[model samples]
Target: MTESAFRCLACGDGHSVAVHKAVADYFLPTGIRVDYVRCAACGMVQQYPVPTDVGPFYAAYPVHARKSLLQEVTRRILLSPVYYDVASLRRDQLLLDYGCGDGWFLDRAKRRVSAAYGYEPTAMQASRVAERVGVQVFHDVAALRAPLAGRVDVITMHFVLEHLTDLSGTFALLADLLKPGGTLHAVIPNLDNVEYRGFGSRWHGFDAPRHICFPNADQLKPVLDPLGLRLASDRFVPFPNTLAASLSILFTGRYRLLPFLAFLPLAIVWARLYPRGTRALTFVKHEN
Candidate 1:
């Protein structure tokens, strides 16, 4: 391990423990092993040697995978901003979906908000999503920031915070993009999940280099406070894909539909009982 990866990006802790080594690239089998390190001070988990050329790693990403009508309907309902009420959005409001991914949410959001913009870092995918969803999708962060800074009423980042390398910078940039009293809804993987203790390296939340960090609300308090981003509220929410993936790893190394279906009810019940899984954290910008 080197100095860069050894130090915790979340809390600037210099010491960490290598929790999981030789972690496979589960999404695409890119043949690159990612080592997991946990900060002793913050208890935040992150990938060692954080991925730089993650493009190759995301080549076979499943966000674009075709789904059955039932799957699509359920996904739309469960993952939609409408599901979480996205800061109690209204038809007069403007919203931004950072790393919006295929614009499914944006499609749903159009009926509820005055304007919906998306920022997908992948240019090709952004084009396709823009064409498919008929929304202003910006591939460049500078382009996204230039026009919308301090103007957007609401922003949503779904399982996106974990994929970035720069923690403080990303938060600051997102905070800067918000209108005064605007809200940011972030869906993050909960590191405190009981499954994390049972699965360790096999936990789907720690998706190797693809997911740079896990839920670190405690560690991030210092980072968000100065930015005027207040933690309005947060709650445990189960992402079916996350549960299915974890259940798959529990059964085999990959997805198994029958077993996944069989155990899903139990998993949902367990998630409710323990109440630590995917977290929907809402942060509101101060009105000053």
Candidate 2:
């Protein structure tokens, strides 16, 4: 691994050591090589030498992608079963979906809660949710001050944490927004899982430069500790959808196979055995 000067994204208190080198998928044509690193002080992991072209990375997300039929199937099969179990959601609770691309989850969440809203930095994406789902979608955290302060019961970040450039600041803000005893449900790739271990640099979850930091529970603890959030419970979902896709890329360097086929048997196995610590995870804040 090539060495580069780096600091922890969360605590900013570590010497970052180079872990691996890989090409990024976010800025496609550029094909920039990024050096992945692990923080010595806090154990937080991330990529160094990120490209200046950061705006295009998130802008590429298609508005309403979640509303598509395939995404709907995956959402039901992958997300609802593992992360969105109804027991955690209660009536009269206010729910917020951070980085809620097109408000699909926001729409579904409204069914179980008194109010549901979404926050997306992308204007075009947020507008699509506003027009299609009819749920309130704010441009950023600042915009939600009036409606969200001390009111949200549960905050959900589905597949969104991996893309953030400000990990600690975001969670700190989340702590302030949540009501006492509020739950923060986040689903991101676990860097310490078996799949990630076996695949090494080729893991599909890497998603290259776009995935700025991939942390396990140990690495994540330091980031969440200051916010008074604790890991109430954690589970892993080893759905093959992403594993198959990553393996395909490792072998052929192209992902042309149908997305459903990639996840079918894996989803079945995931449904049966219910692997925890790879595909999905959840956490709740401590009411101090």
Candidate 3:
């Protein structure tokens, strides 16, 4: 890989300091080490040379297929708050779940909302999910935007924003897709979480190469401000899966759920008290 000048994706500032190095992917045996840096301008952490060829990496992504009962339970627990928020505000309205892997969330959401659609970039997975869930699955943004632009009542990108490389452009597109007073909800790993400080490079939040940007509220506000998407609420939302991921890296160098089960009690307490490993933010498109 060729060395290029470090540029902050969040703030557009060119100055930063190496914060973490030699971070390995816990999912794959790629033997790749990633370096993460913190931008001085906005305190955002990001990976450099942002993995352009990510298709091969996600070929074996576990979530692309069916999940076990335990996995489903934990996923619901982690996303309960988001579901509640969406349900309260988007009752009987149109909803879209971007990056809807396997359409699990979209499937559940369809029961609550008047209409639910999903967009997944992976063609095979999208087709499989659309068939399984009986909900429309779009393969690209254009397909999603063509029908729903400026009409979607609720749009979600749960645990999806960090995986995107073009943060600014994506937010701009989301702003366009949302109707006035519509909500855009997102869940992302918090770079400032206690687990990140404790685990450092081994932090599950830094799922190297896959999670390209580590954004905080400061990093996100500037991008959404000009687009008329005001930050309505920001809260720390912890997921026990992160602890499981961290322990997997420490012990087996891969993802496993045994540690997660053992840590469930402590994870619950920590989630209530700290709630920092992940964050949920709601951005509302202002009515003009």
lDDT score at residue 44, model 3, on the 0-100 scale:
86
Q: Which digits, one per residue and each the tens of the lDDT, describe model 1 over residues 1-288?
A: 475547677887778887787888654557778777888988888887766677876876777554679878767655653244644679888899888887777777877888999888888888988898899999888887888899898998888889888888888888889998998888888878677787776777777758887846677886788899899888777565566667787777755567666766776566655657688888899954
lDDT of 3 by residue, 137-217 (tens): 988877776788898889989889988878888888888889999989888988776788888778777887578888877
Better of 1 and 2 by lDDT: 1
Q: Give the TM-score of candidate 3.
A: 0.91
C-alpha TM-scores of all predictions: 0.91, 0.86, 0.91
Preferred candidate (lDDT higher): 1 or 3: 3
Worst 10 residues of 3 by lDDT: 81-90
Report every candidate's CA lDDT.
Answer: 0.78, 0.70, 0.79
- Candidate 1, residue 95: the lDDT equals 92
Give me the candidate number with maximum lDDT: 3
Candidate 1 C-alpha error for residue 30, in Å: 2.2
Off by over 4 Å in 1: 80-83
Q: Give per-residue lDDT, candidate 2, residue 164.
A: 79
| Ranked candidates, highest lDDT first | 3, 1, 2
